[model samples]
Target: MSTSRHLSAHIDRPVREVYEYAADPLNTPKWAAGLAGSIEQVDGQWVADSPMGRITITFAERNQYGVLDHDVTLPSGETVHNPMRVLPDGDGAEIVFTVRQRAGMTDDDFARDADAVQADLHTLKQLLER
Candidate 1:
């Protein structure tokens, strides 16, 4: 089993609003720094450029439960499952992302991934709040 970290950011917006905005993959690069600045739909799949080369991003079906899970297919054909959520936090919203440490990753690598997830969530918060 791998280690996991749950990173989140609180956004000054309603859960429905945040869910509507973040549910669209086209809006990803605007806040998701881990992905390239652009993404596109090709043959019904969201494709983007990544540090490891071209990749495919597949998100969970839209739902009322605020689940934003997704799977990222790497160039090597390995797919990583990412579970996320936009939860109600009083009048605001809390966006949560689960980061898991893959096999062969060191403690520093896992920490970096957690940091990146936190930063990405923060960006999402800033965008939605504005």
Candidate 2:
């Protein structure tokens, strides 16, 4: 059994612009402060210093459909896949992030994860709309 929560934000920008910005791991530290402390490219792979220690960020291949799926490899050798996207919505764009509940996580912890995802999306909206 898998459980996930979807959080989204409407950004006043084109889908391409929003997707490009968000898909770039280098820019994660700006909006995803809670997730990424610093990001650097090591051997062509994006790595970041996070609360969980150094993690590798693997992104999907560049595409026209605004798919931004990625996997985060934790220091414990655990890899978590995150599904994300920037979709065209009227004149602007809608960014969506899927938060998956880890095994054995309490309900309160899952709620907090949702809240965190929402907060990060809000930050992304503000940063892009500026």
Candidate 3:
């Protein structure tokens, strides 16, 4: 069965600030090192050169609700949906990333994925609050 793990970080920035920053695909290379070593916009899509090879990121339409969902298409042509959101929290905001465990993946792999997401979130928080 497929499963997903949700990880989050509290950033000391307003919801709009956090959402706008994260929603911009260009910022992926700054905080998501584990996913993309380098990312650039190409043909209206965010193309990433990652350790896993070249992949493309397609983000959802920008809106006022702080939704930052996107899809990652691997070199294998398999696409994975990433659900992320930024929510207002007092004077700051909470950023959440949902990590979906791929089919046939082992527990160790799932754990590593979660850890990676956590690390990415921490990195994003540090970058924003710096």
Candidate topping lDDT = 3
For model 1, name the residue pairs that clash: none
Ranking by TM-score: 1, 3, 2
Pairs of colliding residues, candidate 2? none
lDDT of 1 by residue, 31-122 (tens): 98775567999999999987568999999999999999999998989899999999999999999999999888899988987887788888
Model 3, runs deviating above 4 Å: none
Per-residue lDDT tens digits for candidate 3, residues 6-123, read 8999999998999989988788889988789899888878899986799998898999999989899999999999999999988999999999889888989989988988999999
Tell how far residue 15 is off in model 2, in angstroms: 1.1
- Please tell me which predicted candidate would have the highest TM-score against the true structure: 1
Model 1 score (lDDT) = 0.89
Q: After best superposition, candidate 3 residue 20: deviation in angstroms?
A: 0.9
Give the winner by TM-score: 1 or 3: 1
The true-versus-predicted C-alpha distance at residue 78 of model 3, in Å, is 0.6
Question: Once superposed on the true structure, which residue ranges of model 2 sit more than 4 Å away at CA?
Answer: none
Q: Residue-wise lDDT of candidate 2 within 30-120, one digit each (tens)?
A: 9986578899999999999986799999989989999999899989898999999999999999999999998878989889878877888
Clashes within 3 Å, all models in order: 0, 0, 0
Please give the lDDT score for candidate 2.
0.90
lDDT of each: 0.89, 0.90, 0.91
